[model samples]
Target: MEATLSLTDKSGVADVRRRAIHMAQALGLSEKLQADAALIVTEAATNIIKYAGQGEITLKSFLEGASQGLEIIALDRGPGITNLASARTDGYSTGGSLGAGLGTIARHSALFDIYSVPGNGTALLARIADSRDGALNGFQIGAKSTPKPGQAVCGDAWGVRQIGTHLWIALLDGLGHGPLAAEAANRAVSIFLLAELSDKPADVLRRVHQGIKTTRGAVMAVALFDTDKRMMSFAGVGNIVGIVSSGSETEHLISTDGTVGYNMRTVRPSDVAWSKGSVFIATTDGLSTRWNLNRHPGLTDRHPSLIANVLYRDFARDADDATIIVVKAT
Candidate 1:
């Protein structure tokens, strides 16, 4: 379950908090965890009202590694925090409000990340794990999918499959936004779940192309990362963006220009060598292509989720179903 709630005033804080608690219950989080979720979102919402003036709080249920729980990303365009370090300390407040803020949220969160630039705004992420799960393993992957405004479901879908060191990631953007588009994306993911593990990117795309032909059809990309071999093989249809970055250098992955399950052209997959601390990113065209990572210093070292949020926070077009997958080789 996922929702992007707008907090325009103090009343919006209660609404965001209530929805967060409900999502926590739906995800089977413990009472203690539910309370923590409530606290984190409430504090985040309050911060937006008291400082940013207007902002959004997104609550999403996610399954990462062996853990399952809630992920919250709070975004605002108000004056950015000048000193993040000082703001994170307990009992620290800029306005006449309670000091409980980032420090308390960090303590309750299994993962916490914040990125802000003065006058550019702030993006913060917190992941709270279910009580029964306490560990994370395998490939480190982070993603955010937002539906077009006024739509109930996003036309974009993604799935991940990992066996030992062989990790497969797929990102699909259906023809358009809303129900018809979502139909194509959901069907493709079903076929992906049942596909053979040995299938390369081309094989996977072909199977999905055949399986989802009845729907609106979609533009899809699949990447297979063989961590042990330090190689990545990828293929796709249409205009999905695939990128690999290490240090200051970047490389692109090629995707043929055609709609899958409809007018698909011959499938071709490419490969690139993985370097130490390299990051692989895949995104639907819902984001502006002009976004550059170099503008934000030291952001690459943060969690993949943080990186994804920062990109979405800055570059999302807001007129279409948007999704981004950030993968790091373990």
Candidate 2:
């Protein structure tokens, strides 16, 4: 399950803690683990409210082989930390409170990473798993989505499934904005999750098109990667964009015109080579088509979540549901 909460005031801290505890219980965590998660969230939320004034927190479930855990991502646009190393030190207070927050969070988490710039704000990611052996089995998947202004839900959605050496990723954008559009996009995501992992990208989209015929229709992109073969197969319809960076050069995956479930034409899968350092990205039309990697040098070397967040922050349009997904071949 995935949940998001806004932290704008002191009360947000309690809400985050409650949500964290609820998530831990839902995941069958022990009482001690649940309490620890709540405390960590409380500390993170308190810092956001005290210093940043406003921020957002995302809680999502993660599975790695037989182990499962909860991942927390907190994002803010306040005055950023000038020295990350100093900020992580114990007793180094910047907001008049005890400065043990970041260090404590790192101690409780199986994986922890924080990124900040003096003017670009900050993002923190923490994951706590039940497995104490410290082994995780999965590839990285990161994305960001925000609803259009004044809308209650975003009309863009994404999904992923991995089986053995094969991985499938999908991005859907409904015909327009608002609830009806969200309905179409969410339906596509549901179908993506239910479809067989071994299905080809072209066949998968064809099935999704048929499954969501009653909805308003959506523009969809699907990418299937075979790690064992070091190759990728991609198929897309409508305006959704796909980009694959092969270290030496970037290749653009083209999508045919027409909306899925509405007026899609003949669909064909494009094959591309993928390896350990290759990067894959897909985005909805809510982003400007002019997004350039040259402008943000070294971004490809960062974590996928940070890369997605940075793209969303810089390229997202204001008038529509914005979404972007980033995945790196490993």
Candidate 3:
């Protein structure tokens, strides 16, 4: 459900454009939407080659209710946009070409967001859902799930479920890499989404643990967010990292050192105060734990998807499957 392509020269543009169109067709998007995907990736690839000299494009497909969406993340370490505001305008261009790129990209996208720093890099996010009406209102989510460089299947998985006014977010890293681990992660999510009764993080996790015993097992974390009470209850096991951040303040979520399904330990959910405009990030061990948002100016305010992309681009260890979920409080 994901593909990452490296763009270093103009010759690679056609490959990316074709990939986008094929993916759009595969996702059952309309012909117009398929054309839109072609235009977006074409413009994005051209910009990367002209401005940054080299960059990467990540294509991910997602399901929103009955509709499907294709997301594109364009990342570059070029001489960052000195005036992102002007760059986004319809008639402005610094690369001596037509300036209609950003405006056209945004116009055709169901969701669009970008972040840039003068000396740092730039991250752009655009999602074209088959239909926007199926989206649930209230908050935002951006996630990146990728397998190891040489592996065909990723061993990490994540999901979000709505329960009344609360939201349950789950992240899991299977025991190891490749097919067996992917099976474990997939099996855990099936149990997470099908359980009959409780909405509690601990209870839901218990169900998953029991259902996944036949697989290799996984390192997992679950959080339940109550929007009305502004509280989040977190329960986890192993090294799955959970973080809540706002401005310069941050808190690390606590988890016991045990693998789910294979070993048993206390599963206690801890409540933390959640505030408006704060962000919660959950990650597998594939990403380095040393990331700090304070270092990336204006990143906290962009769309959750862009934030997730920037973090993944900068902090990925690249040796194992990586999955990161960035959920923002409204």
Candidate 4:
């Protein structure tokens, strides 16, 4: 389960902490761990309120390898930190009091990352696992979805499944916005989760196409990684954009000009070498394909969620539902 809480006031911060503790308990985290998670949520939400004036806190349960945990993503459009290193030091306060917010969050998390520009904004990711040393053993996944303006639920949805070195991911954007479109997207996610793991990306997409035939249809993309073969098989229909990135190079993924479950064309899957440290990203057309990762240096190496949020923040076409999926080859 995932929950997003706006941080406009102290009450919002408290609500976020409440939800964070509930999520930690749901994940079977011990009392001490749950308290630590709650404190992290409190600190992050408070930082947003005290410094940014307005922002959001997102909480979700995640499982990567043997580590099952909770992830907290804090975002704000406020003035970005001018000195991140100085801010991380204990007792350094920009908003009064003892400034242990970011530092404490990092101390309690299994994995911690922060990316901020002096003027752009700041996005922080804190992952607290049920056990110590919780890391994604072979794959790293990140995804984000935002609803159309004035809507309660987003029409875009995505899912990821990683078993050992084999990882499969699907990004689906329903025909349009609102509940009906969300239904189509949700159905695609369900099918992707239950589909056979042995199937290739194209085959899995074929199954998704057939599974959502009753809905309004969607534009979809699928990526399959087989570490044993050191290759990635990719397939897509419609305008969902996929790209493979490594260091300073990027390869744009191609897609047929049709929608799944509606006038779909032949599924053509392409193969590409899966280099270590390579990152694959897929996004619905709600984000402009004109984005360039080179514009934001060192971002690709951050957590997948941060990468998705950063892109969504900068390039999202807010007139429609937006979604981004990022996977890093581990």
- State which candidate, 2 or 3, has the greater TM-score: 3
Q: Highest TM-score, which number?
A: 3
Q: Model 4 — TM-score against the truth?
A: 0.89
Error of 4 at 22 (Å): 3.8
Which residue segments of model 3 deviate by more than 4 Å? Answer: 65-67, 130-135
lDDT of 2 by residue, 1-330 (tens): 888899889888888989999998898888877877876787778778887899988898877445578878888887777887888886677787546657877888776777776776777877767774423133566788888978888999988887778888899999899988999998998888888766888888889899889999999999988888899899999998889887758999999998998998998779999888788988998998877676555567666767787777678888899899988865
Model 3 residue 314 distance off true place after TM-score fit, in angstroms: 0.3
Q: How well does each candidate superpose onto the true structure, as a TM-score?
A: 0.92, 0.82, 0.93, 0.89
Q: Candidate 4 residues 1-330, lDDT tens each?
A: 788888888889779988999999988888988988888888788788888999998899877666778989999888888898888887778786336657877888888899997777789998888655554656778888889989998899998787877888889999989999999999999999998878887887889889889999999988988888988899999998899888878888899888898788998889888878889989997899787686677888887889998888789988999989898876
List candidate 1 segments past 4 Å from native.
131-136
Pairs of residues at least 3 apart in sequence or in different chains that clash in candidate 3: none
Error of 3 at 192 (Å): 1.6
Query: Best to worst by TM-score, what's the order?
Result: 3, 1, 4, 2
Count of clashes in candidate 4: 0
Candidate 3 lDDT over 128-157, as tens digits, reads 776664344456788888999899899999
As a TM-score, model 1 comes out at 0.92
- Taking the candidates one at a time, how many backbone clashes does each contain? 0, 0, 0, 0
Winning candidate number (lDDT):
1
Return the lDDT, model 1, position 233.
92
